[model samples]
Target: MSTPPRLTFVNRQGERHARKLSLFGLRALIEEMQCQGVTARAVLSGTGVLSKDFDDDASLITRDQRLAIYRNAQRLAKRSDVALLAGARQRISDFGIYGYALASSRTLGDALDLSFRHLRQAGPVLQITSRVEDGVIKLRSHDPESLGDLLPFVAEFWRSSNLTFLSRVLERPFPSLRMLLPYPAPPHWRAYGRTFNCPIEFEAEAMEWHFAESIWQLPLPNANPAAAKVCQRFCEQVLSEQPQGSELTDSIRAALVNRPGRFARIDDIAAHLGMSLRTLNRRLASEGLSYQSIIDDVRKTLAVEYLERTTLSVEHICERVGFSDPSNFRKAFKKWTGRSPSDFRDADLR
Candidate 1:
């Protein structure tokens, strides 16, 4: 089968994040329902994922599709707490080596640190930050990149799953967790009491979980600092398998494609992503690339595509590629391909 083109989702927050889930993650979501004896039809309806998709590790599903499947599971389970239950249902092993590294850490703090560094491997859009202040340990989950519509569902899923993971890490029912949820309380808000035995506050500006600093020293049952280090290295290797700057450059390309005639400001894209231009530049430096280089690459690639496949005028092509001057476009086109745009298009016509 032919592969579909990948897509980028820029949320209302003006932050660009992925709207897709790895097939492995989607498969587990589906299996969570099937294991509960729910029929496949209801779970799969509106999910846009086929049976074969679950078995294909390389395939992906959009955020809408994932949420629909979860909602369907909620309906099938006849409860408003589907996200709560399902999130907790996930085991550490579900994350593969990422979970293994957590289990091997010497302390909960180490495991949490590991999570902060590589959590994106499991959920790219979710950002988990950990800190200690005023004798309270705080862990915050934020998704500035998620659309407003999914704020509640996504936050609930991450929090519940995190609570489950923490309980396992500490090898006990985790200490009382004080919570602040970003959205309004739901009809099933009471489920929070039953599922999370803690003080809860809803409609807050952020999702914050506070715990006594004493929880930091709790030893993991499988604590082996040396093994944890080895595992951490492997976990990082897994994450680094992606070509660095891939996402950054791809986002630049997407912004350009979406706004054809206008050049996107690197500063604006960086700011919307809650990143400073310096940090972005440092990250791209590690990839041996820069923002303007990526923009130029995308423009040149698109220019070639337009020239070879279409009969658009050179002037129009120049405008479409964001060049205000036809002469500038001619200079760039020649510099990129060793020929003028017209010559390149005419050569292809032969």
Candidate 2:
């Protein structure tokens, strides 16, 4: 994997330096408060974003702009527990294409993988690293202290949103066994206790949480790996198609997504795009991606959708995804989702 860009600040003459969040993050919080009768201008007053940008799907705003919105939300809330309130109400659907991936994960583990894999979908300044050891599933966030005193609200809003999303996906309240944070308890932090329903370790090494092994194993009713992969590709395409994205990448993705169950080879795609195979390979390599990776991603996606959403046998699904052999497809599916096709289809979500 490529190294993530560093968060560097070189202040010459005290010029401001702040993080940048996607319009997705800004709209998520603002829309929640708007539903509660808060106006966009009221929340984004000093953010320098016009009334027009609030509804623009392609807008990007600075971290200071987001902090201003949060501060206004706190002011309008008039409560110390504003984070919990906002977190409780912030639906994962607020994330657009990303939410579809989370909703269709086969297990909490799958969902976490998708979230961590595309952490930038929430914002550029966020990272959530997760791992499993000794029956404990842990998540450590690099987004802990980016906002100074606004960290508390940011922390709660982030944590509660994840917890709520996890619970909703599993169709059960799956609270953490323990949560770790470096911040001290504020005056009205009871909302934290009420929201998490577990031990909240203050002043810890990092912002982390522990999920019981049982919780991670819980099956999700909407566990369609194929659909989740499609959503993942769509999210990546949208990002790569952004100002920072290459038009070449977007065209490649468009060609791939427009055809389901037809995993096109790089040669075919390149020809379709009216370019030499070597040129197609070079362009995608410039973006640090391989045509094979793209094809495999689509194959994994199609396989899972077939397994979960169709009565077609595994062999049929394998052929549909372009696998010539049943055995080969089974191994690939297991590698993609960490579950065999039979086990995935037979497992009961309840």
How far does residue 28 in candidate 1 sit from its true spot (Å)?
Answer: 5.9
Best candidate according to TM-score: 1
Q: TM-score, each model?
A: 0.59, 0.58
Q: Which pairs in model 1 have colliding backbones? A: none
Q: How high is the CA lDDT of each candidate model?
A: 0.66, 0.65
**What TM-score would candidate 1 get against the native?**
0.59
Every candidate's CA RMSD: 11.8, 20.2
Model 1 per-residue lDDT tens digits across residues 1-350: 11111222222111222343443334445566776787677688877777866554335455446656656665686556667777777676666667778888988767766776555545534434455677676766543223344556666666677677777777777786689887789999988887778999988766678887766676799888887888788877766663233656555555555555676798987875568999988988998988888777767866775675456789988988789999999999899889999888889789
| lDDT (10s digit) by residue, model 2, range 115-211 | 6645555653333445566867676654244344666777877777767767777777776899898889888767678899999888886887787
